[model samples]
Target chain A: MNILIKITYDGTNFHGFQLQPDERTVEGELNKGLAKTLNKEVKIFYAGRTDRGVHALGQYANFYSDTTIDIGNLPKVINFNLPEDVSVVDAKYVPEDFHARYDARLKKYRYVVHLSRYRNALLLNKAYEYPYKVDPDRMRKALSYLIGEHDFNSFMGKGAVVKDSIRTIDKIDVIEEGDFLYLDFVAKSFLKNMIRIVTGTALEIGRGQREIEYMKEALKMKKRKAAGPTAPACGLYLVDVKY
Target chain B: MNILIKITYDGTNFHGFQLQPDERTVEGELNKGLAKTLNKEVKIFYAGRTDRGVHALGQYANFYSDTTIDIGNLPKVINFNLPEDVSVVDAKYVPEDFHARYDARLKKYRYVVHLSRYRNALLLNKAYEYPYKVDPDRMRKALSYLIGEHDFNSFMGKGAVVKDSIRTIDKIDVIEEGDFLYLDFVAKSFLKNMIRIVTGTALEIGRGQREIEYMKEALKMKKRKAAGPTAPACGLYLVDVKY
Candidate 1:
């Protein structure tokens, strides 16, 4: 059966979501766990990849295995071999022809910033400690400039190798809860470092280091150097995906 | 000078709050840090000691140092020798007669319960995951019976090393946010494993497995077996101590 699984992982202990030669990865653990449960080598597919230290609250993926594993028991069987940092939240049977990556859907990413002067022990590795004052209202005004389709070449990092720089952003929201500031991005697809770069630029504007119009000017310039530094990967999280 | 330091720690990585012969502890780190900065061994006193795997968000402690370290720089100096899991959030120079343990007027403990069917990856070892359904209202009702001055021998664990069983609870509040239930306990002091035992017993009453009258019966009976099992240390946190 082709089984689709929803997973949540703490990426602090992982090198990244993708596989590396010697380093431990989320995909590596999933492959190992799947192999043990299916009693054979099994390949898995995922919705997207996260950078090092990036967490995931709702990441989707799928795998095909020959066994009569029931839907309710899939999570238990796969988790038997998985570690504590990685866990399967939901599992279901998908069509044989379905592809997890190619499926048309919108992805939602959430970035968290700890606005406290001191770091929090309870939220270590879960949110980035900015330690700087940022006005959420100003940040929201800056986010409004990127609500529609645009070439986000300025926000894309230099390490990104994507040929298509144009992506549609359905929504951008800045929410504050307690000492945390959350940035939520809804998009069909995101270029490498797109969300982090936007967050960094908006934070600069919120700090009054840059004018609000800088966001529009940076987009028109289409230069990575014109944008702010990339935010830390620890603050980013793959929160949801809608198909 | 008597230095007052407020600390926060993730106890999952340490043995406990107090020092041991060889094992790592919060007091051991403080002593090491203070000794390195002051160029001499310094004894550290704390408001209370937490069990292994229990965390602290606002634990108070004090140490005497002859070195003239600035109040603003003391946290930095002490944290230099400490581990990543333990951090000094606030530091100040207090009067020479001030004591962290004896002079405290109130101590507050917070216990978190993740009321969900599955474990949360982001909160591992930070909150207890309870799969079964529980009624917070019932638990609060049960908690009211244990408030005020009472002899808590029935709720104290077997490892308790205290001569006085009578303690006064100033306040008890139960608040639920999202999928987590927070139980805040305020008291001048507590016995060994007292909060955990009370939490476990109250949880049973909340689950309807036992009646609320069990709380009154347990206190009058003054037997450890009369109470419920000791809850895990991960969910209990020393959140606040006021002098």
Candidate 2:
């Protein structure tokens, strides 16, 4: 039987989401947690691999197990065995053929920026600090150009070797709450460091370092150096993955 | 001229707020930043010292310098020279007699708790995570008993050696927003670990491990062991100091 699990974790303690042989990773920790709880070895497949120092709020994974454990108690037991920074929120039976990665329909990500002069210890890892005064109106205008389907090769990180860089952006929004500014994006899938690169370009525009027309040139250039610097990984979060 | 500067820092990167030999502290960094910007030596007096791993949002300090740098520009220049996690928010000229510590009126602190199954990587150094269900109503009831004047000897840490353990608590409030719970305390002064001890006791009451009556008993007992464990230092923040 296949089981679906919803999990959240602090990415700072692990190497990344993908499992590595000798290094600590989110997947390795999850497997260790499951093996302890189920008293058997388990192989799980995750929806996507997050980079080092990245976080997730509603990440999905699937595992195959011959024995049945009480689904309601899984969250409690997994949390009991896992470290303080990782937890299983929910567990449920899914279709035998269900795939966590292939079946995903859409994904949502949010990037947080703290615009205040003072730094917040609580937000140290969760938000990026942009000390310069940003023109929100100019950022909004630049964001308007990013909405819709486009070839995002210029925004892709050097490690991304995908053959096709075309992806549809469902929405792009800039919102300010108190001293925090959130940049929300929805897409079917993302290239490596795509969100961070987009954030960097937006910040450049907001700081009056670039113009909206530069985005068009960058997209057409299809070169990694044509865009702004990749924003820090601490400020990005995988908020949800729809399947 | 003498100036009082309101500063904020994310303490994860520093040893603490006090200056010590062979250690990276907030004061040491501040002095380095001021010296680089002002091109001379400077002395600063702080309202209080925070321990390692503790944070501050509104830490008060007074500095004396002979430079003609405008007070308004001090925050900008100091922040530009300082590290990303440390910042100067406000700088104002004050009388030479003004003292940051002795002349202070009130201080406010905030303890943040993330009560969720999943750990947030971004909030690892800023919030305490507890998987157990918390009864907010019960916590509120227990916190109310802590408001006003009382001898907080039981709530003080073992290292605290004060002539008097009595202090006045102006207000104590427990508020929940989204998945975060914050305990805000306003007081004229506090003994070491007083806030952490109070928070742990309140948490016990919320979890049904202790009753509200236990709070009264603990206060009367005036024994440190009678209270709950001291909450971790990472979750506490010096939020404001008003004079």
Candidate 3:
């Protein structure tokens, strides 16, 4: 039987969501925590892999288990064994054929930027600290170019192995709350380092370092060097994965 | 001439606010950054030292320099040269006798707790992750005992070296916003781990683990064991320093 879990985690302590040899990763910790709870080694599957220092709110995972432990107690058991930064928000039985990754229809991500003059100690790792004064209207104009499907070859990082660079972006919205700015993107799929690159390019436009039309040119050029630098991973969050 | 800087730093990557050997500390980083900017050795005077993983909003520091660098560009120069996690919010000239630590009249601190069933991946290191449900009204009632003047030795953590534990708490407020709980306290002075201990005790009362009146007894006892466990350092932030 397959068990699905709706989870959230602070990814700062882990290398990323994927398992790596001799390194602490979210999946490795989750597997260890599940094994301790069920008294058996279990392999878990994730909907997607978040990079190191990237967090998730509604991350989905699945694992096969034949143990008799009550599903209701799974959250408590896993939370007790897991570190304070990782938590299983909910767990339930799923069909054996249910897939966490390939079956997903859409994914939503949010990147937060603290725009205030003062740096918040409490928000250090969770938010991108950009003290530069920004023009939101200019940023919004740059974001409009990213709302539809594009080749995205210009935004791809150097080490990405994926051959297909075409992806669709459902929507891209930039909203401000008090001193913080939130950039939300909904998409069926994203190229490697795509969101970070988009954010960096948009920030440059907002800072008056680049024009909004640069985004259109970058997409048409389909060259990696045409886009801005990739933003840091700390400010990004995997908000939700819909199936 | 001496330049006093009222700065804010996100301490996520720092050992603490104090200078320490063989560690990436806020003071050490600030000193190095200042030296790099001014092309001379610089020493900074801080209001107080913060623990590892702790944050500061209005931390004050002062440095002496003979260079005629424009004061108007100090923030830009220091910010451009400093690490991304550290920033200079404001800078000004101060009298020779104006001390960052000794001349401060009051300090304000805030501790944040996440009370929702769903953990916030972005706030993992910035706030306390409490899975149990909390009663805000009960927590507020318990905090009333901490207001006004009191001998807060009971709330001081073990290994605190202080000759006197008497302190005047100007105000203590418990605020609930969505699933987040914030405890704000203003005091003339605090003993070691005083705020954390108070927050832990208030959490105990809020969770129905203890009675509110127990706080009164704990204050009178002047014993560290009488209070609740010290809350983690990650959730605490020094918000302001008044002169």
lDDT of 3 by residue, B1-243 (tens): 878887777777788888888999989888888998899888888888888888887788887887677787787788777787777878888888788888889999999898865555556567898878888899888889888988998988777677888988999888889778999989878888899999999999999999988888899898999999989887998888898
Q: Write the residue-wise lDDT of candidate 2 on B92-146 in tens digits.
A: 9889899899888999999999897655544667888776789999998888877
Give the higher-lDDT candidate: 1 or 3.
1
DockQ-based class of model 2: acceptable
Off by over 4 Å in 1: A65-70, A94-98, B66-70
Write the residue-wise lDDT of candidate 1 on A1-243 in tens digits.
888888899999999899898999999998898888888988888999988899998888988877778778778677768898988878888899877788848999999998866666667788888768988888898889898999999998777778789989999999999878999999989998899999999989988899898888898888899888899898999998886
Residue B236's lDDT within candidate 1 is 95
Cα interface RMSD of each candidate? 1.8, 3.7, 3.7
Tens digits of per-residue lDDT for model 2, A59-99: 88999986666887777787778776777877889999999
> Model 1, B127-234: lDDT tens per residue?
887867899999999999889999999988786778879999988898989888899999999888999999999888888999988888988999899998888999
Arrange candidates by TM-score, highest first: which order?
1, 2, 3
Clashing pairs in 2: A10-B121
Winner of 1 and 2 under TM-score: 1
lDDT of each: 0.87, 0.86, 0.85
| Fnat values, candidates in order | 0.34, 0.32, 0.32
lDDT per residue (tens digit) for residues A31-117 in model 3? 889999889998788888888988888899998998787888778778788887888888899889998988889999999999966
Candidate 2 vs 3: which has more TM-score: 2
Alpha carbon lDDT at B36, candidate 1 = 83
